[model samples]
Target: MTISIDATHLADVTDFLQGCEKVVGSPNVLTNAADKSAFLTDQRQRFTGAAIAVVKPGNTAEVAAIVKLCNQFKVPLVPQGGNTGLVLGSVPDSRGNAIVLSLARLNQVRAIDPINHTITVEAGCILQNVQEAAFAADRLLPLSLAAEGSCTIGGNLATNAGGTAVLRYGNTRELCLGLEVVTAQGDIMHGLRGLRKDNTGYDLRDLFIGAEGTLGIITAAVMKIFPLPKAQLTALVALQTPDQALQLLTLAQGRCGAALTGFELMSDLCLQLVAKHMPQLTFPFSAHYPYYVLMEISDSESEAHASNLLEAVLAMALEEDICQDAVLATSSAQSKTLWQLRESISSAQAKEGKNIKHDVSIPISRIAEFISVTDGLLQQQFPGCRNVTFGHLGDGNLHYNVSPAIGASVEAFLDQQTAINLVVHDSVHAFGGSISAEHGIGSLKREELLRYKSAVEMQLMRTIKQALDPLNLMNPGKVI
Candidate 1:
């Protein structure tokens, strides 16, 4: 929590701001208290930082020039994209000596090639706009997330974000084919290639994709796109247990195969929270079950075909008693309503009370056991703790969260964060699962990473950080 601002560095902050102003007009370079506040806090408000100035560079060249001047003045610069990250990775540090480099002005769709199934876009472009552009081109950029409207492509790539569709299209790493990055020392690496087969010396694109802006600043990228699905089927099913839900998932994948795009699972507790917070949205089922799943399948076929396919899967699931009740969307309006129920889980949890969130992943086969065992242990250890389990079941990732009991205060429940994390993360490690499934190791999980990662892995990360940014000025004190 200690933030140190060297006195000598303070003397040079003004000159650094002036240099940035020359590259991108003084108006774009903000030093006022009000203008800098937006870039100081993260989306989750977990950490509030202080920056000397916030600079908005319009293009890659401007970003290069600003980075070059920061290197010369020995001033650390934090590359910010939309500021929609759950972890505090996109925000400036509390040192009050760094500059928050905003990429919002760099929003632009550079190119879209439907033939090659690739879309090259600037880093600052909103994710929703990128998706819409692909749709306009008769293509699909399947990186759908809740924050698509506000989050930028650069932040998504930086964290290697995984949304509900990761089961089908993979994370940002697999979506990106090329990148244009600016080195820590200010040299621009123009590597935006849409080619699918490139056996180059080194895959530098990957080095910056999930590096969280510690290695370099990403300006633009060439991402893989796909043909838009002609039809999609959506369903909401009620299950008695996680075991039954896993059985249903396996059965659906066997029947639907590649057409199965999304398979999400949630607890009745999650549904109750959603119902309590969002009364306008109606649940598809008449009665609530212990567990629920909102699944979707898409294909290049007619709506009737999609509906028939979903019907067959549901019929088989019912025959096997894997699901207690089920409801398939008959119209696009109903499909959206089913999705609303699934998407409202997070927001409703927020409305309920303070909750501790754990985004972890285990093998698909062990997921049910992990959930049941973890729930039992948590309830036994911390009496009256409410467990909210849900996530992309097809990919084996779960957002296992905990909220305080009805009478308990949020502060008292949060006091057990350390104990809760240890127990939950320990179980995940024992199952050979990851502590951080989607979110990166920002300051929040840096210590956890050190405790779990091997010495060789940590050393290799440090070696790469040292090579890319020898001065350690590029997002200093993050990741490595």
Candidate 2:
């Protein structure tokens, strides 16, 4: 007997879920609101949308089946992985009409080719775990970030994440060799060959890699690995301003060339926050400066040589007044400690107050000018404000964040976020910078992206959005 019922009622959705779960088994589908709340909310709680049910598909076929059913029922889908995204991309909307399709159970390492140096992994695999697997294989999966512990490979690929290794190993987009996706109509596009040279027509791999789930659902990926850098050196430099940091970056590259893998800038206000929040660090610099840079240099077998080269660069930078002082990590432990100070800025800022964060980028040559211009404009506009400047300066990206004046309530201060972001992002525009650097244009910057992106770019993105997701079932109300 064929049974039919209403689609909007909770019982109707639950009934539909029961039928969907029959294809996979009993443990993968959920309908209870309390149980699904965790999946509906984002990591930062900034975006919490409603979900009628949460579905966990364990494999490619299962994901396709779920998508087909959702399409037929007109239930919007939200594809989620580790829930680590910051811009409301993975979460549902306030409408509560969508359901999250969790990909965690799809976790698997299908194969590892140590010679060709690639690892095929399911989208649900945690990033750090993938790195560990590569490490065990005596190779390196160089894409890395602080959230590696929890963020999924799918999330990183979906956003085309750029982490600490971008200087040496480009972003996640460069590291990925191929992808396996579940189309909107439940067709499996199994583009899962580890081919090194395939000039095969349209590179579909690139489309799904950074589509943010607007085009299709990614189930797994083939990631490129590398022979590990045999030697590495990390150091922290003290600078008086953004200009000094910029000069120090130039000196390091000129001195070490390709060996320079990382160059991150920080601020005194950031350090103060670290010391105030995370006490493990003792502040290595002799004195505090307005700006700082923490960087790493790596080579095939030149660990000691790289250390010496960094010291030589530091000397020249100091003499040239590009840096005030410096501290080179002598041991791995000390290097990690130095990194802790740099990495703790985000957490410390969260504790301080509502920080208006701008993960922006400008021309590599115009970083210093962008900082100076934006700093002056911000200070003049929001007097008595604390502007904390820093980021991966080597890659033309900066986390130009600002905290409210001391003791200001977040309730009142947040109202001006729009006006403040306008001034800051406008300066970024004047410098020919991207409003959304590596963070991807999630709902947070959806409007801001429009302000910076040209009409032609927006039109192209919309065309792609319409082409791949004509029915708009794949993570609707996000990106384009």
Candidate 3:
């Protein structure tokens, strides 16, 4: 239900906003309906919430002051970054009592310590900007995704996002060494130390990294960077099934070792949709296969070395009948084209129609079996339903989305979202997998989290929430 404040509460809200304006100028405090619209809606446009005001803090100090005012006035606030999150973690709820504390103005690269292999950046620094900065210093900040152009580092930390390079560099959590957080009590925790090893006590940095702003607001961070690879190569391999893709994965890993940076799995239907909607992106293969794997290798040696390594692996796979065919990207343009196909699946699915999406992960060994069993089960229940399955198979994360059946009404198909989620999530659990892999348990999966997690786990999470945010004001109604 939408929150309607009484006369006294409205007066209190006015006072709170006034305090916010004092902390972060009147111009930065946005209360107009139009001004707050963009921040209220989620990335997928599935939900649009209401908020009292959208406040943009200029820096860490301003953020702390605004948060302090929130405490004094007993007003809940939602910390938002680029609002590119799939789950409803970044947006406020339907209740209009809360305010959106935007960290967009906090964008800044504080330092780039190439010697230490770290980069210190504000929470609002655009992910692509961070990558570019690291590149400028001849270092690599390898956290990459479709939304890197607009998504912020703060949100990345909040969600602990996993991207393409996760096979090598790991998630946002693994990459980050320290954080500068504004606690629930509006006190700044200055922990931005660029250290690879520090076992002083409780890891406070970790607690806030994946807390989704429920525990505290991440203002800035010290993230690990790596030396740029000498050569990077991309290849697309056509495989008959998920199991074969897994086999090829095992083969590639055995052959390339650390050089295998990315291994993505896409179904033929995924590319079919891409071809249908994104006609401009030419499909490389002459014929189609049931499944495909996009393998990437980053070599510290020469380009010829990288190419030779990838070719040898593909040759072995083909000889063993593990894959039907392979296309090695000979040029940079060709490599980009190959990667585009892997990245464009989601957008292609969107252009086709509305669908239910599940960001799930399975044990690497059981992934193929999980897919086979789950697909069969789904087919039995929802006949002819289109499964647009694809994701970072190397990391065992799958974007196992479902589209409407041929000639099926979109609304009718969407109405079955709850039932569909039950089947998929239950199967994931049965196979020792996670319901939410890369995406955090935002409001979308809060109930599902409760259903899946043990009582002890739930209680422990609640305890942490209670201990950290006693008032339950920081991003209320998220995570736990």
Please tell me which predicted candidate would have the highest lDDT against the true structure. Answer: 3
Q: 389 in model 2: Cα distance from truth in Å?
A: 1.7
Q: Rate the local accuracy (lDDT) of all candidates.
A: 0.89, 0.85, 0.93
Candidate 1 lDDT, 95-161, residue by residue in tens: 7878888999989999999999999999999999999999999999999888999989999999999
**Which stretches of model 3 miss by more than 4 angstroms?**
1-3, 6-8
**TM-score of every candidate:** 0.98, 0.96, 0.98
lDDT of 2 at 84: 89
RMSD of each: 1.8, 2.6, 1.4
* Runs of candidate 2 exceeding 4 Å displacement: 1-12
Clashes of each: 0, 0, 0
Write one digit per residue (lDDT tens) for candidate 2, span 259-357.
Answer: 888989887999999999888678996677888899899877667777788889988988888888888889889898998898888999988777788
The better-scoring model by lDDT among 2 and 3 is 3
Error of 1 at 315 (Å): 0.4
**Residue pairs in clash, model 3:** none
- Alpha carbon deviation, residue 202, candidate 1 (Å): 1.9
lDDT (0-100) at residue 53 of candidate 2?
73
| Model 3 residue 433 CA deviation in Å | 0.6
